[model samples]
Target: MKILIDINHPAHVHYFRHFARIMQSYGHETLFVSRNKEMAQRLLALYNIPYMDRGKGRDSRLGKLMYLIYADYQLFKISAAFNPDLYLNFLHPYPSQVAALLGKPSLVFSDTEHASLHHKLTVPFATKVYTPACYKLDLGQKHVRFNSFMELSYLHPNYFTPNPAILDVLGVQPGEKYAIVRFVSWAAAHDFDHTGMSAANKLKAVQTLAGHAKVFITSEGALPTALEKYRISIPVDKMHDAIYYSSLVFGESATMASEAAVLGTPAIFIDNDGRGYTDEEERKYGLVFNFTESNADQLRAIDKAEAILSDKDAPQKYKHLRETLLADCIDTTQFMVNQALQFSTAHPDPVMPVNS
Candidate 1:
């Protein structure tokens, strides 16, 4: 079967990279289409996955709304030629719309509940919706729940193993204490009104964490000159390795927090918006801590980080928690590939997500 996969974000590339390869090895052809986001294209190159460039993206709400038609047209033109049996993406509206016009099924993988706008536009046309059980919003019968976070699609033990060599690239030795803190640009539609740490709080958080460990900063927007010196200097694809060996991660990016948790690193998530997967990671597994935009809660995150750093055993404890979390989740990469094939192939395979 021919499958068309849309990669809009860097994380989406990771979400489908492994599944695409496995599909190809089993005699399926996968065509990759991507938006011209900085890191998405870079990481796709790093993964050695070739794709068609759909063009640049917009950060403003008005620009995004205006550009949707052009994006849909571009995708429609491409899908017209590719004639894919199915369309796939990490919860985007474009592919699903194009798939509907072509009378094809679109499988959307999603976990972010705050993205109400995207879901509202895409779900009606989507053939299937795959989301984590922790997701709070119900999308009715078309929704399928898996007891795993979308990050696990690629980061699961079945597909990934951390390489300490990443530390060498960062000019850091193994066992050295360090942390990864992500700052988002708050420019996307869903990001509207949702805020992360303020400039003052960001500076404070950095100063506080610096006293506990070497801090590496990753941000979607520009940093002040004072913080620019701490911007991570390494190949973007090597980020997971950096996260894996880090002592801890605290950030505005819920995806990063969840990634850190599954990698056995203690994580503290802070933002006005909370994600269900990270909530599960915090309450069920004790691998992550969540905080809101309030000053007191944000301060609590700093305190938690200091406490984790002070306790040498914190790493081992989180690692054990990761194991238990893994035991309860499915191998999402395999699950995605099989789900695609089951819909279009010979075996008439009838399967549901393990957790369901």
Candidate 2:
């Protein structure tokens, strides 16, 4: 079987990198095409995943609209040449539409319920939309629910193991305490009103956490001069390497927060929109704590962070919880590979490609 995958984000690379490898190991061919979403290509190179670059995406609404047309034109030409059996992406708009046009099946994976516009634009064109079982919103008849988080596709122990050498990259000595704090720019369409870790709160958290452990701040936007010294300077692909070694993750980005939890590190997620998987990670596994962006709520989160760091047994406790959590989840990369192969064979496209 031949598969064409569209990677639009750095996380998308992680989600499908292992799946792509498994398919190739089985004697199948794969074509990876990616849009420039900050560090996506660099990470792909770090993982040795070969792919075609679609170009860097735009910032303004009008620029994005223009880029869409250019991207689809390029995709059409690429698909005609590759003549793939199936198209796959993390709910990308272009591949789903192009696959439908080519009379081939496209599989889209999604987890964000709040990306309503994205869903409406892409879901109808997709042959099937697979989502996590904990997905809060119903995406109608085409939505097929699975029992695992996208993070499991890569972060599951089956695919990833922490390298202590990465600690040397971060300049951390043995037994030294550290915390990773992430801040998103709130630039995505769904993040219109959703905000987390206000500037005041960010400085406060930094000040409070600095007293306990080395604090490293990863931000998509500008950092205040007061916090300039704390800015993290590590390779893009090494973000998880740092997260795995951290004692705690306090941030607005749920993805990194969840990434921390799955790695046995406790995460305190502060956002107005609490995610389903994060909620379960907090409620069932007790590995994550969620708080809204409010004076009272975020303060409690700070207190919680301090408490977790102060507790000598928190690492062992979270490690046990991670094991319990892992035992319940499936190997997501294997599942994805099976789904792409199954969909291709079960519903073969009769229309031959122009290149064919």
TM-scores, all models, native as reference: 0.96, 0.93
Off by over 4 Å in 2: 346-356
Question: What would the C-alpha RMSD of candidate 2 be, to one decimal place?
Answer: 4.9
Cα error, candidate 1, residue 99 (Å): 0.6
Candidate that would win on lDDT: 1
Candidate 1 lDDT by residue in tens digits, 60-105: 8888887788889999999889899999998879999999998999
lDDT (10s digit) by residue, model 2, range 80-192: 89999889999768898888888999999998887776787799899899987888988888989877778988898877888898789878897788999888888766687
Worst ten in a row by lDDT for model 2:
347-356
The Cα local distance difference test for each model comes to 0.87, 0.85
Task: In candidate 2, list every pair of residues with a backbone clash.
Answer: none
